[model samples]
Target: MGNETNEFDRVTMFGADWCRDCRRSKALLDSLGVDYEYVDVEADLSAADRAEAISGRKNIPVVVLPNGKHFVEPSDAELRGELEAAGVL
Candidate 1:
């Protein structure tokens, strides 16, 4: 599932619907106007593996930021910080 926020321009979210962190991250990203496409780890095995390869963890809510970096279960504060740092917030 996806909800678009125009400010981010680009965002790739790696997660599962069942994950609370994923839910929180998505909510924050949306509230902050961060548009993103979602990749569900459970529903999409390939993405899950790829995310694991990069993060070395099976955790949900692994966000691929617009600048081409990854964040593993980052907190709301962290996401806000990143958005501010990227000048999107």
Candidate 2:
């Protein structure tokens, strides 16, 4: 997932292309028809640090909501809650 999203109330995903968890997050978002913006830390230093700062781990699939609330390695249920909260679902 790159900085290519389609919905408003941007959901920013900070991850690398090689990350499976990131891929899972991307697939989930796509299945929900909720467009989310993606930032590749592999290419952007800011994104890497941002994800690290929020998650406290170098874990992939760190998702930042429009309001700047973040989720680290969240489950599908958790992600659904975020989508609902953001009125995306």
Give the per-residue lDDT digits (tens) of candidate 2, residues 1-89.
22223232688788888988888888898899877788899999888887787767888878877766677777888888877986768
**Local lDDT at 64 for model 2:** 76
Top candidate, metric lDDT? 2
Q: How many clashing residue pairs are found in candidate 1?
A: 0
Error in Å for residue 71 of model 1: 0.9
The best candidate by TM-score is 1
Report how far off residue 13 is in candidate 2 (Å): 0.5
TM-score (C-alpha) between model 1 and the true structure = 0.80
Model 1 — which ten-residue stretch has the worst lDDT? 1-10
For each candidate, the alpha-carbon lDDT, in order, equals: 0.75, 0.77
